[model samples]
Target: MTAETLTVVDTGRDKKREQGQAELVAAAVEAARPGLDKIPDPVEPDGDGDLTAEEKERLDTCIGGVELLSTAFWIAGKSLDTMAKGHLIRRIPHKLEPERYYETIEEWAWLEYGIKRSRCAQLRAAWALGEVLAARGYHAPEGQVRELVPLKRKYGLNAGVAMYEIAVEQHGADKVTAQRLRDLVKLLPEDLALKDNDDADQIARMFGGVLEHAEPKALSAGGAIPTDVRRGVDRRALDLANVLNRRRIPRTEVERHLLEAFADEEDTTVFDAVLARMKENKGK
Candidate 1:
């Protein structure tokens, strides 16, 4: 046949495969819904020697539905990962308006695939990370790439990107292995994951002094300080108090200083007392 004829034949095959896949996905969803609906009801045998007809039917339906739903969900997750990888590698977004593809992907994920935007974002980030890995001569397996995306998303996008960069820099591109990347990802502080620098900084400042003391005490004593032990102070306050006392400042002294500093301010007594209580609990 001619080149044009061959092209037409290839297109037909592609369309047929696409149609078949769509049908299968629809069938899976349809099958899963019935199972999901029955999940709330308990599937128990009747007190009699045998289960009633309705109970028997419900048990069979619920079990089969759950199994089908589980399999369908697994398949759907794999398919999404594959689609995300293809979209990233092919630079599909560039075919349309620049950056429009990100929004388009979110919309398509929600409308067509019933996935949320956050999940789509995870897939996108995973694909981008996978590309980076491939370029560095570390081709991560498909499952590994998918697994890394959720960890990256936990830190938010900017932080995730920053982590990837940091990992590459700390562990030379050539030396960076999948396990090394996983370890580096885990090292990221939860506070650092906040997208806003101001928020992250504020948290660090608030908990910084307390964390230093609390961590050691918890380690040495082998227990965490329970919150709600004091009227105004929580576990965090207790931690801060412990740290201050470790520096040789007495709880009473700290309380006196705070009370004097806030004497002019109204409703400062509660705050002062909490600090004093924290100091009292220090070292114990």
Candidate 2:
């Protein structure tokens, strides 16, 4: 066999050493089952007829059902993808695009699990799958899979890179670096454009920061650092670094005031501060 083929064989051996073949197959099988969208759609709002208490409750319950199923499928799909890649590795390569796979898997799990409105079933299933993978020595990747959603739109879903595209348009690399900021502050598309140059001017005043296009860094101390934050926020930051590159924030500054805002120590404080500052400056 060629060197490359030898490498594959060696790597395959390494994977087996890392996690046994039997375990991987088991994970793949479990991940594939319980396909998406098993529940019926919610009832239409009462438009022509008088509403009955039972009818209203049923409709409400169904609406909740949709929400729960969607969330569970999402969780299950994420967990399965991770497990598949970690376990199966070369076998049963996932031909389906990442995002498409996610949607499809979610639908499958929703139907298969018969999850209730509480979404307890889906969460349980995902958690159980995660536990199984963990027991087999599998771990999910740190960052999310990008564009696995899709580059273009289809089936009424937006492009996978839509968020990045919007971030690029609005803040450019700033979007990539400060992804956590954008999400935490809940900045809108309109905010993409500087609502006012004055805010930019203020940021310049405080931190010597200006929005510029450049590669971002994996993690930087240029912004306020927090000792603690939700696992979700940290994950977003890591994702920002992974997707945008670590050098995205080439020349930003952190303000003491921003750090002080963490006085409440909410952990999400950095986001709160940045958001508050942005809004405060926007009004000016």
Candidate 3:
């Protein structure tokens, strides 16, 4: 046989081998993935119409099954990380351009489930947090760690990490249950002002009364401000209150200061000024 013919045959064989390997990998992933019998059919009416009886039944069944499965997984101490990763790996190959599978598991989940990518990511993070806590010897109750996932997002990753470390060190893994962890996270110093104090328990109790009274009211649907924006405001207000309490500023005085500040300026400028003042005072 000619050298040219031999070279062409070798290249063809290599291509076939690569294709076979890809197919095998895809099949293995698919086989390992959770069965889809648990997921409900996604078909529904296109517009502002109600679902048909069949659709409604399917939807209800799906939701119920999902809730049951979720609770079961949580109770069984199964990590959502495993589920999320397996789902992405299994489904990515089915896409027309599988090369884009590396984008993000959350994005892939959105494509597959039609849920918001951010929500999917939050659940994934919760599960991952559970794994992290477990590995750190802090074995919280089955679903306890997951409950802190939203707080993790709210407080920021660095804050969450610091809280976990501090909780483990101060309270010990056994003592840091879900509720205790929540309380501990709430007691985290908003800024660097009070971090020098090692008494998390004392700090939590000191601010607990103020925090209880400062709970944000439910936002009305017709309100101009978005829920997230309102939550941000509430968080800032809480932070300010913490700083004030740390400085031993009386509640009535803090209220008077806010009234004066708002009377002068109605915008976020007032908030910024107050926070700056509080931080400055804390410095002294």
- Give the number of the best model, judged by TM-score: 3
lDDT of 3 by residue, 1-284 (tens): 99999999999999999999999999999855555764665664655788778677878777666645544444332333565556636535535576555356555555665547666555556654555555555555445665566555664333444456555666676677667667654443333233434353444444454443432222232257566754555466567868767533333344455566666754767878778988999999
Indicate the residue-level lDDT of 35 in model 3.
56
Alpha-carbon runs more than 4 Å astray in model 2: 1-50, 93-284
Winning candidate number (lDDT): 3
Give residue 212's error in model 1 in angstroms. Answer: 14
The sequence of per-residue lDDT tens digits that candidate 1 reaches over residues 27-114 is 9888656545556476456686787787778778766765454344434554667766566434445334457454355655776557
Clashes of each: 0, 21, 0
What is the Cα root-mean-square deviation between model 3 and the actual structure? 16.4
TM-score quality measure for candidate 1 = 0.28
By TM-score, the candidates rank as 3, 1, 2
Candidate 3 residue runs with Cα over 4 Å from true position: 1-122, 154-158, 168-171, 189-284
Model 2 lDDT per residue over 1-284, tens place: 89999999999999887778678888898755444453345566667787778677766666665545434544665565564445533333234444333334334434545544335333433443333323433331112112212211221122222333344445544334333424422222111223222332242332222223322323343246443442334455457667867743222211233445555566776778678989999999
Cα-based lDDT for every prediction: 0.53, 0.41, 0.56
Clashes of 3: 0
Model 1 deviation from native, Cα RMSD in Å: 16.7
